[model samples]
Target chain A: MSNPNMKLLYVVLALAILISILAPFLASSDPDGLESAAEKIIGEERFTELEEAEAAIDSPMPDYSIEGKGKLGEIIAICLGTIGILAISFGLGKIIKA
Target chain B: MHIPDSFMPLSQALIYWAIALPFIFMSLRWARRDMDEMKIPILAALSAGIFAIQALNIPIGMGTSGHMVGAALVAIIFGSPFAGVLVLTLVLLVQGIIFADGGITVMGANILNMGVISGSIGYYGFVALRKRNIDIKASAFIGAWLGLFISSIAAAIEMSLAGTFPLVPGIVAMGTFHFVIGIIGEGLITAIAIGAIAKARPDLVDDKAVEASKEVTL
Candidate 1:
């Protein structure tokens, strides 16, 4: 069994992950708060003013999570991130003496 | 924002990947000490704190909230070598998984740009500023701002290199959006967070974390 503290931390973090995952489904499609203000001042053209946003830097996946690869991708990302973190932490514990 | 695959040319992205390889090698090689398992709590808390802070939308005109990425604050709290990058990694993961703030495919590049660039560079910058005996809060504010500002440029360059944007327009576009991003959110948050850390957890900080105030005599 995981240490109680570790379990608690994991539970909290996991809940956050769940909420974050559901965010797109639940969140408003309205202009993000700041964007709304900027739109009021500069009009829709304002966001368009950025040269790259007009050109190529506007990646279609700009903010979209690549929701495909089904559940596999999401599960894999969490595992990889968790593993990466665990490895880094282990290495740091050895090195920095933190 | 994470620069997506669509943003980078294969050639330039490969170049960054190459650069990243040796850098990570050296960073891992250079490590000399160890941290504690308990410290993970610190990292998790710090990461969650950053997420919450970033969640607060500071209204910057033009339809966007410039969120604060706490690279600089984490650096100060954890020191550069070990704790710094870890915080960045956690923050990026949360952003990627939860908010879709960045795409998973481009996560490596985002880590390089946000975590590696700003977290590490900002750490050193705070040190340099402290050498002048600058107030720790001001030191943090400037370092955080500079870290985010320069990293924005680095992201722009990387994006341009990858052919994310047309040459002239890409850099210009990245610079304009991030310059504002740095000023309104990054600077203020850096100041506030650093101040809070200094006050609440002085024990967590390393003495040498911030650089000396003045040049020393041999």
Candidate 2:
């Protein structure tokens, strides 16, 4: 079926790819506000300990990158992850509406 | 922001889970009632777009960064705050399990803060403005900012209640930085995206029934 907003869809898809795939490389590798604040409030060591302590679950792409795959791999992992998320969300919505 | 596992007090997590579970149920019912099969693909596409946007963490100086949560964006565009909740919950769940960005145990707290709180705020903010005959695009921009602002405060409160930090300082820290960044990030993204949709497929921008329902306060 032809989408009425096919042009909009293409724009969205292009933007998503650029942000998820290309932009990650350029993004500052700094901790976010909460993490930065947490580090300041409770010394860096403790903060590190807190985050490190939570390594209980073995996530496939921990930290949004495949271990040892470096920059290119990070891009691929994040891109795939993004696509997977969309599929799950759309798939669920489809099933529910069905 | 995604809260880690042990950072959230178990009691607080349980409380948020209790609060958030009902919203999930309610949104499910809303989705069923408000959505038709034809809208599913568009809904999915929008959700996917939001997912990518959330992952893009823009630098806001001071060695701190913030990503677009996109709850407000989703809520405003979809014209259903419930849809926002569901979309955010899905994103957070995916990030939590696949990337370990958030913890499994604290998922409820994350969902409550990032999804329900922000989504409701954005939804109402837009609805309220639209009732006042505000421009749809302008309403969406304001709604996105207000929603993000309020959600940031809520997250700070959660951290305080969990004993991770002092209430006042936590609120100040989160509110200040996020307010500075979230307003611009959320406002521009939502406005631009909605603007694009308005240009390409104007029919989807403002549904009459959704606009009418906006008058009823949450």
Candidate 3:
């Protein structure tokens, strides 16, 4: 017999993935839910106040987006995030089965 | 919302990675018990749900906003499969890469605190509560609330360990903010999801019904 819930779960997961992957391009650049609040009370300068020298570190992949680093970090982030997730799921799936 | 590198110190981020490593190991073992090919889709959908939910970034006091962590939610819906971890991993990666919400170095830590703690510990707590004649609504409420609450404090402690903030203040702030966020978001989500699942698919909702106490054993 076929397992119905599993299939439904798959379709939902796919839809969620496409949305998340496109979130960067699709999302409004405006300050997010919390950022909007922060700007209201503290003004835009307040977020800046939180910044510290520790951010000055010369890491290649400093920010989340593929900023200074070439295609290398971008590939790593995407590949690792996706592949890593898959690997964990598959590998752990095996263990759980054992 | 993602915390940047500047606000949190390297020491704190490093410690997060350290803590996450072991959970990853433990999760692998947990997944081994009931590995089912059918559960993959549920896990994936859960990951996606987490992404969509985290995108909300609802406002809280102190010029901060908290979104749905849903770690416990994932665990409750789906077991300890890497799907919860994967879902959170993707969310953090996107936040770092696209939104600049969270930093790259500490991404693993964020996943551990939000994903692992909530999914594993919180879910297990829910299971334990479920073992007794606990009410479904209360169980869902406690599972999600405690999951986020505990994970947030754990994150704060991890930060303090890494010297992100002064120990006392860090705990006080992250804990307080998350407590509110968890109560509102986790409670609402868990309750609604439980209700919907119970109505639509009682079997899937696990412990949602009153007599669910001994109906099934996962």
Candidate 4:
């Protein structure tokens, strides 16, 4: 990559990190558009039931938070996920380039 | 929009996966052939940035919130809908496996809605508008908006097909909510991101359509 493009990547990475850290606090607690729509169609209780149904695999970081970690845990979880995605993408890019 | 596993029957999920595999293959081919070394880092940054932005859900009113899906932004930046598919597939995998933000079984449907459909519409829409001599920012905004809105409608249809939601009401609700979300979230964010990236790295953006527009205007 050129110097300018590298600089842009760094800037984007920094911004992404910042957003991940802040998201737990700033992000709305309300249901997202799809969730809200589902709730409207199926009723809130049924929607919740469906969302809570057992899945094939349980995620280590379910709902982007660690159990009993509160908001701080959420911040950590999301930030880690963000950084992990960066590393994964970078690695994938390198492998593809090679 | 991320559809949970329970919202889709196993059979329906399998069908979506079948439909999405070809697109995934094509995206991989594009990644190998079209994405050069210089663009790879940009792609990495974009994927990370998209994942981060998706974590933040800003309220769009009416008791709902939304985030940028980033499919349009990816397509427009890389100048290919395949790029959107590649990036979104990776992001969705991580989200499903680690964060559990989206479901594993229903992932195919999510990918189809947010990646293939949104990416195609967003890229083609922007190119179409730019070909008509429209401003870049305006084209991006409209394209992103249309991509998101239509994708949400598609999701509604999928949900209906899965028997999780009644058809017309599901469409009405999802359509209404995403229309508003598309305007305030996807459209604004895509336009801003495109503008910033173009300003910072003009050579990195695919501006052939812009050039074509200039030719037409001249």
Candidate 5:
């Protein structure tokens, strides 16, 4: 890639990282559209059941926020999440293009 | 929207998986046959961007918020709906395994809703508009919005079919909210990304050339 193109790529990646780190902090604690709609339509008790049902698997990082680590943990989780995405994308890219 | 296990019932989940797997396999084959090696890093970067953006939820109102899925953006950039499918699959997989945002049992449904349906339909929407000589930016905005809107509809349908809720109300609720988010959140994001790439590295985007070739044929 040319120097300018490389720089643009870096900018895009940097912007992505910034958003991943900062946006979570600003996000509302409310349920998203699907959840909110389900809650309104089916009522809270059933929605709670749906939420509880989500505990079918034990995840390393539930809800993308680690337990007991607070903000720092979230930052670390975001970094790890970014790395995980990059790894999968690059790995799949290579396999596809190979 | 991530569908948790047992959230959609086993039958609906399995059916969605059955629908998504063939498209995924075809996408892999398509990538192997058609992709240029030079585009790999770009795709990786874009996929990472999509994941990051998805994590960022912009508040819409009524104590709710929405995030940009970016499937349509990938479709438009890569000139292949399947590319969107693959990228979203990777993103969803990471979220499912690490974040536990989505359930393993309903991974198929998630992939189907976010990847297969949104990506393919969104790409085609862009293509169709481009063929009609619509401006690139406008085409992207409309395409992405439509894709997201349709995906929301599909999700609502799935929820209803699973007997989680009534179909009409779910459709109305999901559709109403996502319509706003789709146009405002997804459209702006897609347009800005495409605009930036077009300005900085026009050569990176294949959609323009694809449209040009189609124009000649038409």
Candidate 6:
């Protein structure tokens, strides 16, 4: 963080990680706009069915948490996700710029 | 505005993928030609921030919650919609594949709605507003709001096409819900983030845009 620009990057990354850590406890559990709209238009049963339908690939951390691991699990999952995207984006940028 | 796989039929999903591919290509070209070494860190930071913020949904009443999409923030900072597309595409990919927060089958539609539509509208809208002598923060707020609102409508239309919801009702519901979310979540956060970044690192942002905005204030 010697460079001012690097300092800015570190600050942003730190803030992002902090937010992710807090998200599990602070985030609302209610359905989002799309889900709410869909559930309203089509019955809740159908909406649930649609959501539960099988996907091509099963996510390692579904719903931002490890199964049966509760809020602690969510914090770990989301923090990892936040760091993962940063690393991936940085790596991709380096590759592209290279 | 993440559309799950079940919301869109395979045919419709493929159509969205067809539409999104060209934009993705153009964004890659932008990265190759226009993106310099200076922008790499900013891009990574913003992508991480967007991903993290999206995970924290705030309750917006009516038994629903919403989060900041961050398309406008990225576009405005980079002074290009392609930056929004590029970062958002990456974030959405991770969210879709790793968290299952969004669906893989309909990742194309998600990209189209959140990445392409939101990014294009957010950047262009901000520029258009600034041209009218509006303050930068205000312009960013309105731009972000408009981007999210319009993208929500686009998602509703796609859902209707998939026979998941009726067109008019879906539009009304999605539009109304996101309008509130945009105001409270997307618009406010975007304005705040941009203001903070511009204050701290004027060198990183678009010089002309920041200069013009400063001139407006002074």
Highest-scoring model, DockQ? 6
For all candidates, state DockQ relative to the true structure: 0.14, 0.64, 0.20, 0.81, 0.66, 0.83
Model 3 Cα lDDT, one tens digit per residue, B126-158: 777777867666777888888888877776666
Tell me the spans in candidate 3 whose CA falls farther than 4 Å from its real position.
Answer: A1-3, A10-98, B29-33, B61-63, B81-83, B97-99, B206-218
**Clashes in model 3: which pairs?**
A64-B96, A64-B97, A65-B97, A95-B32, A96-B31, A96-B32, A96-B33, B2-B101, B11-B162, B12-B162
Model-by-model lDDT, in order? 0.57, 0.78, 0.59, 0.90, 0.81, 0.88
Show model 1 residue runs off by greater than 4 Å: A1-98, B22-32, B54-57, B93-100, B209-218
Predicted model with the maximum TM-score: 4
TM-score of each: 0.66, 0.92, 0.68, 0.96, 0.94, 0.95
Off by over 4 Å in 2: A2-10, B207-218
Ranking by TM-score: 4, 6, 5, 2, 3, 1
lDDT of 4 by residue, B161-212 (tens): 9999899999999999899989988999999988887787777779776677
RMSD versus native structure for model 6 = 2.4
| Residue-pair clash count for candidate 1 | 19
Local accuracy of candidate 5 as per-residue lDDT tens digits, B8-122: 7777788888998998898787778767666777777887788888888788887778888888898888888888888888899888888888888789988988888878777
lDDT of 1 by residue, A6-77 (tens): 553565356545534544444334444323333343355644453123222333322333457544454444
Residue B5 in candidate 2, Cα distance off native in Å: 0.7
**Whole-structure CA lDDT of model 3:** 0.59
Model 1 lDDT tens row, B1-218: 45544445556666666655554554444333333565555566555555544444454555454667777777776666335555666556555654456544566677777777877777788777786678888877787878887877787666556543445555565566667777767777777766765676566565463333232421
Number of clashing pairs per prediction, in order:
19, 0, 10, 0, 0, 0
lDDT score, residue B58, model 5? 81
Clashing pairs in 4: none
Q: After superposition, how far is residue B209 of candidate 4 from its true place, in Å?
A: 4.5
Give candidate 5's error at residue B131 in angstroms. Answer: 1.8
Candidate 3 lDDT at B89 equals 61
Proportion of the native interface contacts kept in model 6: 0.82
Across residues A27-74, which tens digit of lDDT does each residue of candidate 3 receive? 344543323433443455755575433443344334324666544544
